[model samples]
Target: MIDQAKQLREKMLQKSSKKPSRQTRVIAVTSGKGGVGKSNFALNFALSLTEQKKKVLIFDVDLGFANIDVLLGRSPEESIATLLDKDLSIWDIIEEGPKGLQFISGGTGFDEMFRLDETKMNKFFHEMSQLQGSVDYIILDTGAGLSYENMRFILAADDVILVTTPEPTSITDAYSVVKMVQAKDPNVHMALVVNQCTSDNEARATAENFKHVTAKFLNKEIGLLGSIPHDAIVPSAVKRQVPFVLAYPNSQAAHAMKKLAHGYLKLPVPYKLGLKGFLLKILFK
Candidate 1:
């Protein structure tokens, strides 16, 4: 596994060091706290991106949680942990979700099936570079935390989409994440998704205030990607192990997700870095 990882690292360095015609768009969808519906947003947003004719790969890095796989009604036999076996590659672990969308599970280390050493895991990490070139977008649904594991993944992305609710605590925690991320990379593409908003007015008010607060305190311009309304269908879809957008494409929340997808595509990308650049930084720096 470590050998394969090293080979991948070399290839990435060779590619990223030189200029490229285009850079793949990578979005790290994270939050200040849990239960803000970050996973739901990530899953449906990937589907929406595919709807826009973009090839999307959703990586579930939320430790111990099986949100994406469960939501898609799938039980993946392989995960990042399986790559340590010396026989499997990332292609072997990827599982099809819905509507031609795909996802990779960041295995829970608790089980024997996923236990891996540093070098072996690095081998798995190296293959991520191959993915950087194959897909149009890589949506990372990272675990909600400030730990090194979470930061490493978030910092490596081309953009960071912070999910927060209208609640005071949610906003405060989201700001903390923004601050942490800013401290790491001030130029990082930061965006906001106000979820569970009850009304259009509330969504506007909450998103605007949060944006203003981040700009005032952090001195960062956080893009207001869009907001999702508080919809019962969301929970109902969860219970049915399906994505709300696929089940209720006409729902307000689903419609909001599509708008967010389009809004994301409209955001100007910082073209200085490509997938190879992000891969090198994440692996070595």
Candidate 2:
């Protein structure tokens, strides 16, 4: 599987130069804390984009708990760690998941990625630059909270999808993420996703209150992306190691994801800086 993926990547790269290039949207999907179903949402969201005939890649940069491969029931033989430890390029490490979604696993020892030497740093940036126009979107599944690593991912992205629940602590922590990011880069664009809601009214109220507070206190306006209802099918799909959108397409959560994807496409996109720009910000800032 790994060899086949690498070959496919080569073909794509070969044809890329012949085609007019467009900026690939880099979206970092994160949360203020864990247990809010952030990674699950990122996976399903990418799959939903693919359903719209857009090519997408999900990079698992969660450092501590990267599990995109586990969620797909397949183990990647190579990962970002491989690019550092071995003589492999970035394309050699990308693995394909279900529904033709591509992803890069954050293997164990991924923390070392932030401490690269000068030579490795250049090589890493140069390899990643090749992905500038290779896909329509690159969704980063970053770790939750306000860690330094997570902040780097958030600041470098074109937009952020902040995932949170209706719980008070979750709301508070989510605000912290926004506050910290604003402190560093006030120009960063962000949106909200209220997951695990019990009803539509609860979701609307949660999103409204959160947006209102950000506007009043932080003086920032966070867009409302969409919400996912608390459905048993999500957990069941997780247990089966299948994306809920595929395993239970008719379920409430699946229907919500499809709607979310459609709404996201219709929204006006903020200016993007592409993969090379993303690498520069992440490595320097």
Give lDDT per model, in order. 0.79, 0.88
Q: Write the per-residue lDDT of candidate 2 for residues 106-156, one digit (tens) a residue.
A: 788887868888788888888777777777889999999999899989998
Can you tell me which runs of candidate 2 are displaced by over 4 Å?
1-6, 14-19
TM-score per prediction, in order, is 0.87, 0.96
- Distance from true location, Cα of 125 in model 2, Å: 0.9
Give the root-mean-square deviation of each candidate in angstroms: 5.4, 1.5
- Writing each residue's lDDT as its tens digit, candidate 1 over 88-112 gives 7666666666866868887766233
- Evaluated at residue 48, the lDDT of candidate 2 is 98
Clashes of 1: 1
For model 2, where is the 10-residue window of minimal lDDT? Answer: 11-20
Q: Would you give me the overall lDDT of model 2?
A: 0.88
